[model samples]
Target: MSLHSVFERLAARPWLAAFVFGAASALALPPVYALPVLLLTIPGLLTLLGRAKGWRQAAWIGAWFGFGHQLVGLYWVTHAILTDVAKWFWLVPLAAPGLALPMGLYSILPALVAWRLAPGWPRVLGFAGAWVLAELLRGWAFTGFPWNLMGTAWAFAPLPMQPAALIGAFGLSFFTILLAGLPLLGARRAFGTGGAILAVWMGYGAWRLQGLPPQGTGAQLVLVQGNVRQDLKWDPSHRAAIFQRYVALTSQGAAAAVAEHPEAPVLVVWPETASPFLLAQDPEAIRIATEALPPRGLLLAGTVRAEWGPDGRANALANSLVVLDADGQRHGLYDKSYLVPFGEFMPFGGLLPIRLAAGGMDFSAGPGPSTLPLPGGLPAPGPLICYEVIFPGEVVGAERPGWLLNVTNDAWFGNSAGPYQHLASARMRAVEEGLPMVRAAQTGISAVFDRAGREVARLGLGETGVLRAELPAAGPPTLFGRWGRWIPGGILILSLAVALLLGWRRPSQV
Candidate 1:
C-alpha cells in the first residue's frame, strides 16, 4: 500500500529491476554524467542479489543487468554498421545486442559470488570484488574489448580520478563499487566510513595537483582533425581531396604553433590512417606530407603498412604509424598490435563470410608494445592505435617513454558516445602512467592531457580543426605504472578475503 512497499515489490522482480537499474547506471559515465542516479541503481541491484534463492537466479539477474548496461552503453556500435547500410542492413539492428551477449556473461561470476556471501557488508564487499574480478577477466578474454569499465564513471572529473595514479583504473573500480554498495545496508557507521574515503580521494587529488609538473620544453603538438565522412573516406575519387585536407590543416596549424613557441620544435600529428596513399611506399606522398611541416617540424601520421614476402609481393597488411622529417625521411615506424575482431580481422578464419574492415585481406598484428625513438632530440613516445588505448596498465613497455601517443579513426562510429568514451579511457591511461597523452583523432575529440590527466587542449566531436599545445613533461612513474596489474591484483585478493572471512563469521539468511 505504501511507496516503500511498491518499490520493494518492483525490486523483488529480479529480471526487470536488475536490467532497469543496470541501464540507469550507464548514465553515470561520460557525455551525460548523471552520478546521483547510481544511489538507487547500485543499491537496488544489491537488494535483488541478496534476495536471490540460488546461484542460478543470481546469475540470471546479473546477466540481465549486464545486458541492459552494455546494450545502452555500446549502442553506438550500430552506427558503425549503419555506415554501409545497403551491404549490412540487417546487422545494424543486431550489432549492439550481439556485442552485449558475451559482455553480459561476465556479470555471472560476480552475481554468484554475491549470492553465496552473507547479507550486509560481507555481500556488498564480496560483490564488489567479484565485479572487478569479472572486469579483469573480460578485459583479456577472447582478444578483449575493455570498453566502459565502471571506474570511468569517476572519469567525468579529475578529482576522483587521482587514485588511478596509485592503484590504476581497476583498483579505482574496486573502490567505486565498494563505496556504491555501502548505502544498501543502511548503517550510519558504514555511511560515515564511505564519506571519509571519498574525502580522502578528493584530498589526494588536490594535493597531487599542488605539486603538478610544469609543461615540458619539448616539441609542441599540432593535432589535425580532417572530419572526413566515413562513407567517403575510402572512395578512390576522394582520396586526393582527403589527403590535401590533412596537409592543408597541418601547414596552417604548424605555422601557428611555431609562432606561439618559437623555441619548441613542432610535431604535427594526424589521426589513424589519415593518409590516403601508402605513406611507407609512396615517396611522392611522403614528400607532399613533409611540405606542410614547419622548418623544424616533424609529422606523425597513421597509414597502412604493407609486409612483403621473400618473393617481393605484399603478403600482409598492418595498421601503422610513421614519423617523417622535412627531408622526407621516415624516422620511426610503429604498427598497431591489438587488432579489433571482425572490424580489423575476421574471426574463425573468415568462415563467417563477412568482413567489416575495408580491405579483402586481414591485417597482421604487430609485436606487443614498443617505445619509438624520434629525431631532432624529441622525447621518445609509446604509440597506441585506436582502441588499444582503452587497456589499462598495458599502454607502455618495459622501456618507459616520455609520453603517450594515441592515433584513432573515430569516424567509423560517427558523432556518438563511442568517441567520448574512447577519449575518457585515454585520459585514464595518462593518469595511470604519469605521462602526458597526445591524442589525434579523425572527426574531432582531438585533445592533449598532461601527466596529471588535466586537459590542456581539446577539439570537440564532428569538428574539423587543429589543436595546438605544448607537450607536458612526464612525471616519475606512478605506483600503478611501476606495479602494473599487481596493485589491482592485491586489492582483489584483499576484498575477497574480507568478504569470505566476514561472511563466515556473520552468517545471514537469503
Candidate 2:
C-alpha cells in the first residue's frame, strides 16, 4: 500500500489507532529498537488525531490513547501487587488503570496542542513540539513520574543520544519526538530533516565521546544482586535468610574482584533494603555487614534508619545509603531526599485510600543533597535509591559527582517490564550527567553504564549474580550536569512560546 493510503486506512478506526499507537510507544522500552520507536510515536499520535471527529472527540480519543500507552508501557506496576498478598490482587485492577488514567491526562495536553496548532509542510514540528510539551508536563506535574520517556529508548545507544548531556533527557526526548513525527511528512522531505537532525546529534555525540577522558584510574566495583523475594524481603521471619543471601552475594563479589583486580580494592554495592532490619537499631546486623566486607574493600548498601523525635511517634524513618569502610567502619550516610508516594510516604497521610504500603513505617524525607565520600578521597559519588533515580534533573545536582550510584530493590516489581523500564531511567541519568553509573539491584538487572549511558556489562533481570566492572572516572562536567535543568527548561519554554505565537497569528490572519 502507498504511504498515504496506509495512513488513511489506519486513521479510519480511532480505537484501533489508539491501541496500536499505545503499543508502538511501548517499543520505546529497552531490548527493542528504541531509536526507531521515536519515529513511531508521532505517526501513532497523528493517526489517532486524524481519526478524531472534532475537538471534544479528539480529547477523548487522545485520553484513551494516552491511557493505553501508559497502561501497557507501565504494566510492570503489577510487581507492586506481587509484593503484598492483600495489595497484589487489589492493585492488579486498581493501580494499572488508575495510574494510566491520570498519566493519560498529560498525553491530552500534547493532543490538544497538535489539534490546535495544526502546522503544514512540516507536520512533525507541531506534533513533536506538542508531544514534548506533554512530556514536560508529565515530568513536572503531580510530583512527576518521568518514567518511560521516549529518550530512555536510547538508553543503550550513546552515539545518537549523547546530546542528552547538553539538553538533558527531556531534550533528547523532544528530538526523538521530532524525528518520529518527521515520517508523516513523507520520505523525501521528512528524510531531509530527520537525516540532518540525526547527523548533527550523532556528530555532537561523537565529539563528546572522543573529547572526554577518564579523570583517574577507574575503580573496580562489584555490584551484588541478591535474588531475595519481595514477600520475604521485609518479613521478620525471613530476615535472617535475606541477610544471609546478601552476605553470600557480597562475599562472591569480593572473591571475584580479588581474582580479577587485586591491585584496586573492590567497592561492593548492595541494593536498597538489602537488609530489612534496621542496622542502627540492630547492632548485630551491623556487625555482620562489617565482618562481611574484605579488609581492603568498602561496602555501600541501602537500609532503613529511624530516629524518635520529641513527638513520641517515630519522627524520622529514612531510606538511606550507608557506606562502610574496608574494616566495616561507617564512613558516611545519605538519607534519600526524594521518597516515593504511597510506596515510601503516604500522601496527605491517611486521607488517601492507598496507605503507606512498603517500608512498614511511615517514611520521612531526608535532608539536602549530599555526596558519599569514596575511600581514597576521590570525587564524591551521588547516591539515589529506587524512585529517586526517576527524577531527571533533580538527582545529580550542582555538585557533579564522579559517578552516580543507584541502589534499587526491583524485587517489588518481580519479573515484569517494570524492572527493565526502571533500569532504562537509571541509564538515562548516566547520559544526562555524562557520568558513569553503577546500579546494584536486589533482584536483578545489575549493570554498569558509561558516561554516555552505554551498558558495558549487565546481569539479566531476575538473575542472582554479581558483576565486577571498572567504574569510569569523571570526565569533563556535562553541560546539563554543570548548569542543571536550565537547558531543558529553556527548550520547553521556547517550544511552547512558538506554538502559542503561531496559534495566535493563525486566526486573525484567516
Candidate 3:
C-alpha cells in the first residue's frame, strides 16, 4: 500500500496512530538512538496535520502525537516511582500520563498554528519553528522539565551536537524538526536539504574539535561511584556502610591515580549524598573521610548543607557540593540552584518546618553558578549538583569555571535508561559550554567528558567503581556561552513568525 493511503487510514483515528508516531520518536533518544526513524514518523505527522479540517482537529492530532512522544520518552519516571512502590505504586500509571498531558500540550499549540497558516515549505518551516517554541516554553514554564528536546536525537552522533555550541539545544531542535518535516517534500528535496544540513553540521564539529590540545589540562580527578540503592540510601542503619564504601573507593582511586600521574594533583569525588549524615556537623565522619585523602589532595563531594537559624534551630537546607581540604575542614560549598520541582522542593505541596534534616524534608533551591575555590591557584571547577548540568548557559556564571563538576544521585532511576538519558544531557552541557565535565553519580553511569563531549572515562549503571582520569581542559568559551541561549532560540522564533505570516497569506490545499 502507498504511504499516503496508510497515513490517511491511520489519520482517521489520529489519537492512537499519532501515539505510535510519538513512541517511535523515543527511539531517536539515547540508548536507542535510531534517529532515522524520525524521517518516517514526522513526515507522516505533518501530512496528517496537513489533512486536518480545523484548528481544533489539528490540535487534537498534535496533542495525541505529543502525548505518545512524551509518554514513551518519559516512561523512566515510572521506574523511579516503582523503586519505592510501597508508597508510590498507585502513582506509577498516573506518573506517565500526568506528566505527558502537560508536556503534550506543548505540541498542541504549534501543530494547530502551523496547520492554519502553513503549507508546503512554509508549513515545514512553521512546524519546525513551532516545535522549538514549544520546547522553549516547556523549558521555562512552571518550573521547567525540558527532558527530551528534538535536538537530543543527534546526541548519539557527536558531530551534530557541536551545533549546540553555536545555537543552544533549542536551535538544534528547530533544525531537527525542520529536517524531519522536509521528507514531506518528496525524496529529492528531502535528501538534498537533509544532506546539506548534515554536511554543514559535520564541518562545524570538525572545525571545533580539530587541533584541540591532546594533553590533559593538569587537573586529574577520581570520580567515586557508590552503587547505593534508593531504598537503603537513606536508612540510618546503612549510612555507616555507605560512607565506608565511598571512602574506601576514594582512598584506592586517589592512590592509584597519584601513582600513575605522580606529578598531577589528584582530587577525590563522591556522588550526590554519598555521605548521608552531615559530614560538616559530625567530626567523626569528617575524620574518616579525610583519612582517605592524600596530604595535599582535595575531596569534592555532594551532601546536604543546613543553615542554622540564629535561635540554634536549622532553617534552610541545600543540596550542595562541598569541597574539603586534606584536614577534612570545608573549603567551599556550591549549592544546587535549579532544584527539581517535586524531588527537591514540593511544588504546590505545602511547606513544612526543618527541625532535624534527618527526616524526610524537601531542599530549598540554592544560589547557582557558585564556583568553589580549589587548592591550587588553578582554574576553579564549578559544581553542578544533579540536574543543574542539564541547563545550558546557566552552567557558567560571570566567572566561567575551568570545568563542570557534575555530581548526581541517579539511584532513584535505578538501572534503567534514566541514567543513560541523564548522562546524555551532561555530555550536551559539555559541548554547549565548551567545558569538560566530570560527573559522579550514585548507582551508575558516572563519566568524564571533554569540551567536545567525548567520553574520556565512564562507569556504567549499578557498577561500584571510581573513574580516574585527567580532566580535559575547557575550550574557548562557546558561542552558546558567549551569546547566551536565547540568541539561537530567538533566531528560530523569528523564522517561525515569518513562516506563520507567509502561511497566513496563502491557504494550504489538502
lDDT for model 3, on a 0 to 1 scale?
0.81
For candidate 1, write residues 1-510 as lDDT tens digits. Answer: 996786687776889888898898888777787777777787788788878877789899999999988888888998888788899998987899999878988988988888888888888898888888998998988888889888888787777888999988898888888888888778795679788988999999989877885577567899999999888989999999999999999999998987888878999999999998999779999999999897798899999999789999789999999999988888899989999888789998778866776888888999978899988678888999999999998999879999999999998888799999999999999999999999999987999999989998999999998998888889889999999888888898898999899984333454
Q: What pairs collide in candidate 2?
A: 39-180, 81-88
TM-score of each: 0.97, 0.91, 0.95
Question: Candidate 2 on 1-510: residue-level lDDT in tens?
Answer: 896687567677776667667767777766564556657656767756654656776787678778888888877776677677565576677777877888877777777666665554334455566676777778877677888887777776767668888887788777887777777777897889878987898888888878765443456788888888877776788888878878887787787777777777668888897887776456678788767667778888888888887986677788888888755568888888776787886777657757425545667777746677777765578998887888777777556677889999888777877788888888878877777888998888889887777777899887887888887776567788776667866776677676566553243332
Model 3 residue 459 distance off true place after TM-score fit, in angstroms? 0.7
lDDT tens per residue, model 3, 1-510: 997787778878877777889888888887788888988888878877777877788888899989998888887877777667777677878887988888988899778767776567878888787787788778778877778777777777567788898888778888888888887788999899889988998898887777554457876789899899878888889988999998999899999988887777778888887898787666888889989988768888888878889998778888877888788788887778888766777666645321111355678777668677787776688888887777656778778888888899998777677788888888888888888888999988889888888878889898988998888888888788898767767877788778867766444352
TM-score quality measure for candidate 3:
0.95
TM-score of 2: 0.91
What is every candidate's alpha-carbon RMSD to the true fold?
1.8, 2.8, 2.5
Where is the poorest 10-residue window by lDDT in model 3?
Answer: 350-359
Candidate 1, after superposition: displacement of residue 350 in Å? Answer: 2.1
